[model samples]
Target: MIDLMGYADRVWTGQEDLRPYFSGALREDGLLPVADGVWMWAATGNVYVFRTAGGLLLFDTGDRHTSRALHTAVRAVTQDPLHIAVFSHGHVDHVLGMDPFDQEAAERGLPRPEVIAHRHVPRRFERYVLTAGYNSAVNGRQFRAPGLKWPTVYRQPDTLYDQQLDLREADTQVLLRHGMGETDDATMAWLPDRRILCCGDFYAWNAPNAGNPQKVQRFVAEWSQALHWMAGLGAELLLPGHGVPIAGAERIRQTLLSSAALLDHLQQSVLELMNGGLTLDEVLHRVRVPAEMLSKPYLRPTYDEPEFIVRNLWRRYGGWYDGDPAALRPAPRAELAAEVAELAGGPQALARRALLLAKDGDLRLAGHLAEFAALAAAPGSAEHAEAHQARAQVMESLAADSPSFMAKSIYGWAASQSQAASRGEEPGKEEAGWAP
Candidate 1:
């Protein structure tokens, strides 16, 4: 138990260190011009607005807050109705602010801009309504779960492209290539004449978030292939869904190739282990990216952790259920907790050990011990109460030590829940961005 918990602690600590440094970027109003018929803006998430002879075409809309600015920026450029609005994927940051486009078009009696997305995107809309609770949990944003308020009255995509769709204007052709990266239904908008790839989230400047634990399996292979191919396109500019834009063809190609290299390393390493007939745990213990590879700015694990990437690859080649037999027909969480508690010399012993570990500067390990002991607790179990209290302290210490904002948020949230559990309180669980 001690060694198992220690490994989890190390893994999560590595997770804490994975988030890329927040370069203290200043937010700017959406506004950037490029080429004859193309423009871009970076509000919260980066959105590129292309000015075609037909009408205004928006590559991707930012989150809820940027809607007004998006409208303002577009109106400032041209009063033309938004002919087509493309969503890179079904991510919250990229999809929500599209309402303003609709409103602007309606006010002047123009036809509603056609919502263009991959086939699975409409399904995401359907599922958002049907499984609000499930969607909220997975979304992990502040607005999900308990107070989940997704976009309502979703206008299904009028134009759905299976593999690729060519959007040709007068002397301009923007190719919408379908490759699921951040989401199963991600689409990249390519401008041939402009030599600009408005590659939705497929080529995010931040650490690749393709391995979000709560989300669906990512097409790592497809994503790498897309980038490797896009790298050779000699595009002068690369517009991404999130983060700043990259200029210069050589730099752009290298950046894409480097991003692909990160995934390729992880994927290839996992494949090597799998081919060698190693168990999942054994592979996980040995899985490591070379220091040279991890040193890249783009490959940094800012948004998604590497272990999750390894685990995702395992699932891609493996099956739905993880390999453990106990997990196959597992006991209910409470029952398993109770059994583990009973076996670990009762909860009181667990609490004391956690206290020692916490004091010994092993807060991560202590937190896990406290979790098991705390969860197994019965209402009247004195052992449960003490364990939860110890758990809170350990988690608080861990939170204090966290190096990343996301890690701090996660550990702080967990500590708060632990504190609540100690007093037999229901810690008003607000679902957003929480893994467990």
Candidate 2:
């Protein structure tokens, strides 16, 4: 086959570079005061704690690894018992930091905090359990970190809501509104008295991750709609799940509006192209996020690239079929690769051609050609080694120059794989900072 086994293996490794992104991974671990009583602790994902007359209301619990850090950070500000907790979504990063709180409650002879979430969260947790191994493997590849494991132990929501739930922790009003965006079980908490909105993974200061290629289908239209509604709220302080707190009503308004504009523009462009009978590839090439929009700091493609989003959009409206007849019932990739290699004068010749293409700065196409050459050649043959070595160079080059942390991780892993294969290693399957 065109051998994704090697590529996947390459991707499941440690990331080589560290750069700032929306997620709180690269940021220093600490709690920052967002408002009078609301504090955000930066970790893998942000955990926000609000002081209420009843106790403390937490918007998200950091990942399982950060349980101690989260607990310590929150306790530093207030010793108030946690009376309420909410999961922004069901993603492992946003859902697992409650164990320390559970332990603390037992030690002090107090009841555990009541956890709240959208009704679909328990179902999302079920899916994670069912596909734990698969999710672990795919995420390892997706993040280029083989050590990362998906957590199986999840605290089910004691309070689940369908549409909206209003709670009163003393005089402060906590409004949990269900919105489908990055995940099906997303709840954005709105504090009317404070005029602060806690947007969970909705606007994490990056291009909205509505088109993660490796993840499940995202809710694009609904996400845009949610942003629009939030924008109209005229929130004075915005506390996103992963980023730093954003203050000032005008800034919040502009930020949310711009984010909405970008998503709406991308979705509409893809839909229009599809309606015009253009194939998926044709649409990908033709559709472009407006230059001004992309130029905005928040709209940069640092995580989910626009191209992947285009593919997701196609899947959403037109189904998986890409309108390419050749893709339907396609021959095994190995057969096609063998035929192509033969026509190119065997694998060595194909390797030489790929090297030339990469030298000419056509690394993307060179990667494909090099893959074909390596896969077509007999395993452990000199031809395969040479082809893989050349492919490794091309991938490393791409990774070095890429802007997005996501792209860099994937490309770097692929490069590592190719290099390993060149050394005759077996080809097999494999595996951020905060702001507001």
TM-score of each: 0.85, 0.91
lDDT of 2 by residue, 213-275 (tens): 778888888999899999999898888776556677887888788888888888999999898
Off by over 4 Å in 2: 1-29, 427-436
Which number leads on lDDT? Answer: 2
**What overall lDDT goes with each candidate model?**
0.71, 0.80
lDDT of 1 by residue, 12-123 (tens): 3344221221221222433556556566666556677777787878887777867787788778777777888888887667777678878877888889888888888888
- Model 1: weakest 10-residue lDDT segment is 17-26
Error of 1 at 376 (Å): 2.0
